[model samples]
Target: MKRLLVYLWTAPTTLVGLWLAPLALLTGGGVQRIDGVIEIHGGIVRRLLRRCTLLKGGASAMTLGHVVLGQDRTVLELTRAHERVHVRQAERWGPLFIPAYLLASLVALLRGKNAYFDNPFEREAYKRAP
Candidate 1:
């Protein structure tokens, strides 16, 4: 079916996200499956979100293929709509999503724009969710 194909197409990125799941679990995080997406939060996930991102405080939530990582369950709940927009983006771009997203950020910065805020993908997500 079409859905299966989309999952297959995005599998590589999904695998990358899933690679973090064990770290989350071993460190006391939780995982859930919602609307065919895997959601993860807490433990090292929170720290990673706080320190590993380009943002000063890092991101509260991030989407990778069919997986979403959040600082916590509450933040995940709050950002679901916005992150869903990214899920659709990942579905559209498949394995190229990350590269395309990074490229968008670089382009935004080169244009003297706020890379995260001005990236077209973020703009679209904000338009739908903000």
Candidate 2:
């Protein structure tokens, strides 16, 4: 089934996400299953998020495998569609997703482009986001 395929495809990254679940909880965030996706919200992630200047005013939620981590409930709702596309990308790339994404961004930056906006993954997600 498609669901099984997706689960298997993203299993590696999902495992990583599961490991971070406790940290999410510790930050006053909780996890939920929504439309077959694992959503993690709240906690110290928001405070820590501010440290990532690259994400300033841009990223509200990020998807790692089937898990989506958000700054808050409102941000989660707003970015759900965008993050879902990233879930699919993670399924497609498996454990290679992170490194590949970073490489893409680095290449973009070296070429004097906006790393996030020029990265193929973000472009794909943006195209599919509402």
TM-score of each: 0.98, 0.87
* Local accuracy of candidate 2 as per-residue lDDT tens digits, 1-130: 9889878878888776666668888868877889988887778656545555366564577787988878888888899989999998998998888888889999999999998889999999999985
Model 1 agreement with the true structure over 16-118: per-residue lDDT tens digits: 7988888999999999999999999999999999998868879999999999999999999999999999999999999999999999999999999998999
**CA lDDT of each prediction against the hidden true structure:** 0.94, 0.81
Q: How close to the true structure is residue 91 of candidate 2, measured as C-alpha lDDT?
A: 86
**What is residue 93's positional error in candidate 2, in angstroms?**
1.0
Name the runs in model 2 displaced over 4 angstroms: none
Clashing pairs in 1: none
**Candidate 2 local distance difference test against the native:** 0.81
What C-alpha lDDT does candidate 1 achieve relative to the native structure? 0.94
